[model samples]
Target: MGARIERQKNILDYTLAALLRRKRKNAVLVLVYTLIVFLLASVVFFSRSLQREAADLLQGAPEMIVQRQVAGRHELIPLAYLEKIKKIRGVQAARGRLWGYYYDPVVGANYTLLVPESREVAPGTMAVGEGLARLRLSAVGDDIEFRTHDGSLKELKIARIFPAELGLVSSDLVLVAEEDFRGLFGMPRELVTDLAVQVRNPKELPTIAYKIAEALPDTRQILREEILRTYDAVFNWRGGILIAILSGSVLAFILLAWDKASGMSMEERREIGVLKAIGWETADVIQMKCWEGLAISLTAFLPGVLLAYAHVALTSAGLFEPVLKGWAVLYPHFSIKPYLDVSQVAALFFLAVVPYTVATIIPSWRAAIVDPDAVMR
Candidate 1:
């Protein structure tokens, strides 16, 4: 009992002495470790946030949407089919919508465009996407003009705004009163684009979309998976690239920290060797290093994670709508109810601190085992 108590005291004493003596150097290692962990955490957090948001976005969309798939190309379906779709059981409200694209001079791209089903009133009152609005500093009632890919200017009054919080799927979204839609396009009311349906029960969604597809032979439906896959095609790919790039920087920092922690100076070697000679053991050495790893991780991770969250918030506030391609509106900003569950934090600790401390232990144990005479020599 006495020996164990003595050893524990020795470990605490040596560890404190080491920390105090190497404050500046140790501080740098801790900071670096913290930063690496922080970046990793942010990556994990953001990826999770993206997946969750994407899933939510898909979940909220019309239980099902149908478009025409012709020879592997999606073509617009006629509005006449909406009545047929409505007659189907489990369908609450079925509305005809037009999906297309528009070019925003401000954002400099052809964004996925949305028009109205009603040809009469849709011209003057347009609903701009929240994302496109931010890009142009536009708001409700602002006059927005865009040329279609075919070189026609369909300038219209902004009626309402759509939020793309989940997908912000596209940056340019313009909805107008349908009466104006006919006049703008110089086309008759016979043409329609897409069908959006709200189902009585979600379980009935796939069956309904499938039924619509069967009835309308030419129409293709946008299922929940399709929308999510689209999001993945865009954001997921981009997010992965970002993660890959950021991972390199994080890796570099981790290595730098590991090297620094492992490479104690001659003075530290001497001090540790003396402590060991005076009866310190491996347990004492490990506890001290574990504490060191804990301290460093906390210092780095807290600030790093906070900074990443801030970055996402600021970026989304400024650019969510402009960058997304579909022209769908998304919520401007949403706070991720971060899964700060114990498991997540614990995983981070296990991967970062535990490995770091384990790595630190190897050198610490070596130093502890050194014969004082040999080390002195």
Candidate 2:
């Protein structure tokens, strides 16, 4: 056993020396390999992290949202609908929600206006999200003006700024008094943008949603799980777009790798011939090539993964954030919590590392079995 181990170590050492002999070539190969891994890993890490973030944020979301549909479009829901929904057997509570969007031509972005269900904002004052505050260059105690539906500007003082940690959900959010929201949008006092419903038992959500739909034929029931799924699907679709865009480069890399693996360079062929002539068996030659491939793969993969982790967790994936996040304006500035899935890493390994290793070994095996004189000439 010890003899076998010693022989393997010697082969690995020889592999290292051989790699070092072609420093420039190996360096370039490692760089390209690392870059491919980095790009692929970055996309996976960023998208999955965002998905997790969305899920975590939605955990506290209402079990169901009820919206009124008018001619197949969302319309204001009457407060009267709240009573009907609250009467549903499985419903723990139901309440009308006041919210809408305001377009700020000055900032070239839209702001979400909402009435806080749990707290009251004193009349004539509001709470703004960090992103909105940053865009408007305003802070607490500053007044922000919104163009009311009547072609008039209603100004409100920023009483508070939401904490940056909640930026994912609140980035473009503006919390205002219900009365102010109605006045800004010229909405009737007895109507709301939607209804938020809570349930006693979580499993009965779908049943309750169906009941709500049945009772209010003009209403649409959106469950929390469906919202989560929508977010997941959106991220996945965006990730797919990025992958499609990168496919050309990826294909090129694969072709390069295949060519490199299937056809050994003349120098490499000669080196294998010399080793065979010097009494190294076919298995030993194959083993050395296997070690070389593994060395290069590991050297590339580990750093690539580390770099990707840093890019997402530390830098918030600056390179791919714009495309993946889908927010062109009022882009929320938030850090992605580091998330690693073993399966994802393993998938990346099979895609990036395993093929190259196999390719390296096959060509080396073919060359190893040939007559040394023929190979040398």
Candidate 3:
């Protein structure tokens, strides 16, 4: 046991020293590997975050929504429908909500807008998402002037800005008080873009929605699930883009790993053959090379992951949307804290590090088994 332990230690020490000797060259490879791993982790992390956010937003969304079903037009529900919904058996609360898309004329970008300027909103107040707030060069207490598609001019006072996402959609959310919303959009009391319903028992929501639909035949009472289909498409788009960007890095990593292990120098090959000639077993050679791979992966892994965390912390959520990052106070701010699970870390370590280590063993074994005289000749 002592002899075996000594040999393993020797292998580790030599493997580390060998990598250190080529620090400049190996550093470059490690740095690239680190970046690729970071990107991969970030993509996985970001995708997980997106899924959580989408689920939270969709689930927190009204259990049932009543809308006007028209073939090719936006449905405007009556504001008074909230009262009728309250009388339903399982309904806990009901409210009206307004949502629309706004074009940021100053920045030439569009926003998925939510206008909740009702009694629920504080007076003389409006809220905007961090996205629109920065893009428009507006902040808390900044006066925002927006002209609607229908030639309506709204001079909204920015009351407070909140992160629209708490594991939810962080899109362009704007909130204004009901009285101000009327002035801003020229909307009537009977008209609303959507009706939000809350239920006492969430499990009973489907039955309640059906009952509400039957009760209110004139207006359509749709579950939040149906309404979320449009938003689901948006999340898919964001995830796909992130994946495409990171896929390239993974491809590069496979090539780098292959080249590093395959192309051994003449001296290195001779050294390996000599080790074998002097009684180093094939397993020892493989183990030594595996140690090298493990060291590279481990050393790079933590730094790369922390680098990604730092980036997200510095940029905030702006990293997700590269377009508006310019106006971000911190380039990448991590409002959504990453939730680390043992399984994910294990999977990442296996995929990023273990495979490369195994790749290293293949070439090492080939060199170790070669005839020393033949290699020297």
Off by over 4 Å in 1: 1-14, 83-93, 104-123, 127-155, 158-171, 229-234, 263-269, 314-346, 369-377
Across residues 268-325, which tens digit of lDDT does each residue of candidate 2 receive?
8888899988889999999998998889888899899999989998899999977998
Candidate 1 C-alpha lDDT tens digits along 1-377: 99978866766665566577868976777677666766666655555566667777667577678876779887667778888888888889988776565545666655565554454344467666666677778777787775544577757776667765522454355556655555555545766667788888878888888787777887777777777877767766655666687778878876887786677668767767766666656566567776666556666667766665564555431223233312433333434444344676677667776666666667777776766565456
Best by lDDT: 2
Model 1 earns a TM-score of 0.74
Q: Residue 191 of candidate 3: its Cα lDDT?
A: 86
**CA lDDT of every candidate:** 0.65, 0.90, 0.71
Candidate numbers sorted by lDDT from highest down? 2, 3, 1
Clashes, model 1: 32
Question: All predictions: root-mean-square deviation over Cα?
Answer: 5.1, 1.9, 4.8
Residue-level lDDT for 17 in candidate 3? 84
> TM-score order of candidates, best first?
2, 3, 1
* Candidate 1 minimal-lDDT segment of 10 residues: 317-326
Residue 239, model 1: Cα distance from true site in angstroms: 2.6
